[model samples]
Target: MLDQSLLSQSRAGLSEIEAEYIASSLLRVCPPVSPQHTNLEVTKLLNEHPELISIAVVEDNKPMGLITRNVFMEGMAKPYHHDLFDRKSCIAFMDKEPLVVDQNMSIQTLSFKVLGSGRKTLNDGFIITDENGDYLGLGNGEDLVRVVSFLQAEKNRLVTESINYASVIQKSFLRSSRESMAAVLQDYFMHWEPRDKVGGDYYFCKKFDDGFFLALIDCTGHGVPGAFMTLIMASFLDHILLEDNRHDPAGALAIMNKKVKTALGQINDSAAEGFDADRFSTKQNGQSDDGMDTAFCWVNTQNSTLTYAGAKTALFYIGDASSDVQLLDPDRKGVGYVDTPMDYQWTNQQLALSKGMCIYLTTDGLIDQIGGLKKIAFGKKRFSGLLQEHYLKPMPEQESIIMQTYYDYQGKQKRRDDVCLMGFRF
Candidate 1:
């Protein structure tokens, strides 16, 4: 009897049988092609191979570039787009280094390639290639998602075997506030992210005995390290509330400003020379890069008072009427970028937040998300309009409205930067 046990492989206790099935089914064969074909011919080929995506633009049997469906469509729609019908070759509109994969390349490598091409349209897809630059049919985006989904199975096997335990490692770094005083928070929800896993944007909600604190912090960069800094800052905020006692919102921010500048070590000496780059590693290694921007606030909901202190973070508040939406602008200097730290003057704004009023905090992400292939952003003005339109909806439906509007604006393009949106209803 053929050994049935040989057919199964375990990862984190989940079986690879599903993964193997997917890998095999996805690698299913189809009619493949080469480049150097004309646009007219390629369009015809797409009709036949309707599943086709990228095609290498080969000249003299050597791959010159890639012609993706988007590039072709974009070119065809251009105001100068007239020669497409009688085009000599697809090379004219092809992407020189369009994201590609080699046949022998590991599946991990392939998975990363698809992810790096940024996000794609529902029907939009990617192409596979051989070492010799020959086309190997199309690869569906859903297929890559399936591979990651199955990796969880393999990861589980490792966990069960005690070889490795990585479950929740992806989310392990996210933490909650420690000090619980008289924190009174009625309700709140938010999504803070960069265009990537690591976001330079952050969110914090600390509940006090009588009031609560919140912030929408945007750091220096756009992705990767920027996101890492957000995590570090989040941890820093947690520690500040637990240890340091900065009771008022402005006081807390002033303390935070001093701590941040000390931590980032962006200060100068008597000679006007900055701190040694090498010695700055004591607190922050500066190895992965250091420094960030910020905005801090403390709202005494019980007392109906809002205290604001900003460093490069724009604030928006929407009340029952359109007139209630307000923007709290920051000074020219960000937290780490300034020479002399300014004294924190608490600007207390009195407001009577009725049941229908809302306060929104966001980084540039929400408004800056790519609107279309033409490259428009969702934008501040329109985003405010969206808030007004959804203000009438129940809190439960409001989240859906915001997300739907984001996707509708972003469509299928890759997110250019992190998107942060926090809305609080009274």
Candidate 2:
């Protein structure tokens, strides 16, 4: 049975030309009969082939008209009607102007034509013809709809499968847990949530020789494209810190800028001596601006100190209630762009912390979220207040409280982006 509900659903607003079904699929292979064929012969053919809804009436190998089951049956129901017409040609009862459709016509347009062609054609069916006006076969209205419905279902199923697979890959790239940092971090909290099943925002943590290398990264965009950038960024960070033995956060960023530009073939746009103005001008400007913003931190437990550097990312620190909150700014440049000078330097800040000081690393996704009664941004000011209000709470409890407060403020507003908030106490 046809699902009446599906008939009303739009076909993704695709134009008739874009729909997959054309005249070929809807066309049936029933043979055409000569116009001279008698009514008795036509009745025998339709009786033997119950599925044949219509057959073409042709003369001299050219389509003359269509004889549908209804016209044949109704004509035969009348008393002595067959006796008079039994010797007559089938063309006498055929629809002389049955609707004929071109082979290239979309199913959507075909269905529309069928519905508006008057009630007589409701069961008369349509004729399918090639571009050259040659008779192909007959098309039943019911069959064309079924083909379109199947196409829509298959497209939806494939898209769902692709998204689920991408979600698995995105999760594999995330750090297992902030709890793993307990040995050196003493107390810590982390909240990472992607607005979509797979998102571009992610955090990385790896225990190094003296302490730990931790970073909160936000790639160029969100969803699959952004997620892909995370994978690339992760690979580059791993190589820079582990294989190259580079540990300074600022130096690592410098290498990151160079490598990312090179990987994307944006080296000609760099500020280095090799930069080519003609080559840069010939290409579209800002075409290779894809990159990441990151807060990179190295906690050196060996010296009981913390070092930090940022690439378009920020750090918030609090020593105690007596101390004012400190905001450390990152270099005003992204990691993989040609806009900044090639010799652009990333700076590092070393902080001698109190035994219980708290430090935070976050992406703009958290602060830039749009929510609240006024529908304004949950800006830096509110974030600062949130951390300060709950800094005294235990790390785990603080995490829960902060998340709950965030949700309350968000209310019914859709999440604007992927959010990642990290806190560690010395």
Per-residue lDDT of model 1, residues 1-426, tens digit only: 112232122222334343343323344344433454666777776667654555555554445555666557656667756564435666666666655555555443344344334333112445456677665544554344334333433343332332121112113333343122113444545665556545567666677665677777777675444543554465456546654343454566666665555544434431112323333222233321244555576766567766666665666777676654567776545654445353544333344566656777777777778776677888878877877777666654777788787888788878877777777676
User: How well does candidate 1 score on lDDT at residue 335?
Assistant: 57
The most accurate candidate by lDDT is 2
**TM-score for candidate 2:** 0.58
Give the Cα RMSD of candidate 1.
Answer: 24.9
Error of 1 at 311 (Å): 2.1
Quote the positional error of residue 412 for candidate 1 in Å: 4.2
Model 1 vs. true fold: TM: 0.52
| Model 2 bad stretches (over 4 Å) | 1-161, 176-183, 243-246, 269-286, 320-323
Tell me the lDDT of model 1 at 384. 78
lDDT for predicted candidate 2 compared with the true structure? 0.70
Point out the worst 10-residue segment of candidate 1 by lDDT. Answer: 162-171
Return model 2's CA RMSD, one decimal.
23.7
